[model samples]
Target chain A: MNRLFKKYEGKLPLKVINDIKEKLPKKISEAKLKKILEEVVMEYNKMLVQPGESVGLVSAESIGEPGTQMTLNTFHFAGVAEMNITMGLPRIIEILDGKKTIETPMTEIYLKKPYSQGKNIKKLALSIKETKLNEIVSEFMVNIAESKIELRVDEKRMESIGVNYPVIQKCIKASFKELALSKKGDSIILKLSEKEKELNQLFKVKEKIKEVYIQGIKGITQVLPIKKGSEFLIITAGTNLKKVLELDFVDKTRTISNNIFEIASVLGIEAARQAIINEVFKVIQNQGLNVDIRHLMLVADTMCATGTIKGVTRYGVVKEKASVLARASFETPIKHIFNASLIGEVDHLNSVVENVMLNQPVPVGTGLPGLVTKVKREPEWLKNKH
Target chain B: MKNINVKKHMLVPEHSKLTKKEIQELLEEYNLSLNELPKIVSTDPAIERFNVKLGDVIKIIRDSPTAGKSIYYRVVING
Candidate 1:
């Protein structure tokens, strides 16, 4: 039986063979197994991508057609109130265009082992959230005559977020080297220098002091701990994939950021390719659209083909085309033509667009092959006799 | 402790460096040169542990939702 299986291994994928083995009856005959394996190979071959199929065009239409029906609704309430994610058409555009700065960047961070089981889950979530000075301050008392701005520390709020007085003191000291701070009971008084003691300067220092970064990961503005299945995880508003992945408790393998460039830089281009597929598929699934996963995979592959994420926009994948005319036809026709002529670039008409521009049959589908036939017209004498 | 096995991730597929013989067979099977194949940077975290060099072909075995499983090949290139 083992030898029989070995014989068919080269003909079928290992997963398919393993699946068949698991599902087969113990009492099945060798001949029946052979027949089953043969049939599986036949079915697999029948379902494969055919030659001359315009897959890129098909995938484009499959995803693009559903895009028209998608609502322009930008903000999606992500169960956590006030954390709105960009979704629908605008988001699809943002992702496909490969915009560097996304409208709403976020991350879903999975914790390691026992931490994922709600062991100090709240504390962990709080620690991951960036605590601004304003969030932990109760009131700002400005001493007009003394050139001092006093910040009353909200002790209860600080304790809840696990931030101590010393941490706050350190944060302030690091941020404002010029301002001399003196600890006075629950309030920390900051005294500006005599030269910079104008009312306007005092107010500016007061406003700037409010935004001091106190603790937690820098970019993560807010973190919400929610139970996903049996495990507890965090969904953060702002994304800092590199820093978050470095934390001791974070499950680096599972944690993912919605920012494609971040993923590309942190995890590598392949992961970014997978991210593109998952993100696009998520939007399509949420919108009740049915596009084959292969289509999305093809798009992802194209975007990541050059070992970096490039959008379908003119500056990205379009700019990398081999044919000069294809690049010229996409956008800025005159500019592309001028540059091509200046460089003495040539258009080989290899792609569909260039051939179309020249009023020739596009080299795809039936036009892919060249047919050579000898026209057996009778010789001139024979034709005249007929 | 900071060392995370990248292949263990759900999104990451099984990545293995192909032998010279295997690479030659793959090239012949696809009728493509090394450059015609898709590329992965030599520093890609997924294949970092493999200690792959430039021009080495890496085979990726992915779990596909539509096709159940799919295989992809990428040549390692300098970033």
Candidate 2:
């Protein structure tokens, strides 16, 4: 079986050969196997994309036609009860628009070995979530006469997250150096400086103290430990891929963020390309659409071709076109034309849109190749007669 | 600290730099200039291990759902 597979190794892809090996009958004849392999090669050849095919247009139409049917809404993913992720059309638009700041940035964090098997999973989840002062503070008491603010700490909450008063104090001291801190039974007192003694100032200090960062990885607002298959992984509302991956327990290889820009910055352009394809395809699949993955690949390839992810929007991928007319045709036609004239930019008429605008046979499909026909005899006879 | 290989990730696929001879053969086979090919930034983490410079070609092997596997070539460019 191995020898037979090796014979057709270059002819068929490794995946196809492996698939054949898995599905082939145990008692099949050598001739039948050879015949099957030949047929597969022929089919694969037929599936190859033809030259001069307008794949961009086909992909645009395939995706755009299905996009109209998608619902504009957010849905909570399974196991993540309260977090609402932007899904359907809105998600597709966001990915394609290359919006740097996504509406709902999320990360699916996979853990290593023992931690993934529910060992201190809750503790791990809490440690990854950003804890603010407001979350652990039971009450904020303002004493106007004393020019001080007292914060009653929730000991249970603090213990659950494994944070102590010193940690909170250090965090507050780092953020607010001017304020003086003192400790009471269960409350931490913050005395306002002489310069800031007004009643309103005390109220303002109370509000500011409530938002100080205490512990956990920053930007991760919420975390839910979910049991997927046999392992428990975390699903976070906010994304901090760089910080999350730095943790010792995180399975860095499999952890991924939904924010494309964050992925690009943390991972790279290739990862960003994959993220775009996955995100768009996920939204399309969720909407019950049947568009081919090749279209999504084309979109991803185009977006990442220039070594960076550019959206399909006018300011992104469209702005980088070689043809001036093509850029003008997309949007802001007058402005594009004016800019081109000012710079004395030339329109090469290399693309389909510009040629169509010029009422010529668009340089696509059959029009891509030029004809060199002979007409010497007819031209000579006509010239002699005239 | 144990270094994590970004290339080994499921989404990253396999990326390898093409030799000068291989790149020449590919350019001739496709009838395309080096600049005409798709580009990947030098700073892309997927190719960080390669220690690639500008104008180098990278061959990417990706798993395709339609076809079993697809191969792509991209030239390295500035970030």
The TM-score that candidate 2 achieves is: 0.90
**What is candidate 1's CA lDDT for residue A125?**
91
lDDT of 2 by residue, A1-386 (tens): 57888998878887888788999988998889989999999997898778789999999999999999999878977755678999998899899989999999999999999999999999989989999999999999998889988999999999999999999999999999999999999999999899988889888878888889988888999999999999999999899888888889999889999999888877777788888999998888888889998899999989988988898899899998999999998899999999999999998898999999999988788999988987657677778998
Please report, in order, the local distance difference test score of every candidate based on alpha carbons. 0.88, 0.89
lDDT of 2 at A338: 94
Please identify model 2 stretches exceeding 4 Å from their true place: A1-11, A19-40, A77-82, A193-201, A373-386, B1-3
Model 1: residues with Cα > 4 Å off, grouped in runs: A193-201, A372-386, B1-4
- Which lDDT tens digits does candidate 1 get at residues A278-361? 999899898898888889899898989887889989999898899888888889989999999999998888889998989999
Task: Report, to 2 decimal places, the DockQ of model 2.
Answer: 0.61
Instruction: Provide the lDDT at A308 for model 1.
Output: 80
Judged by DockQ cut-offs, the docking class of candidate 2 is medium
Per-residue lDDT tens digits for candidate 2, residues B1-79, read: 1366676666777889999999999999989999999998898888888999988999987887765777889999988
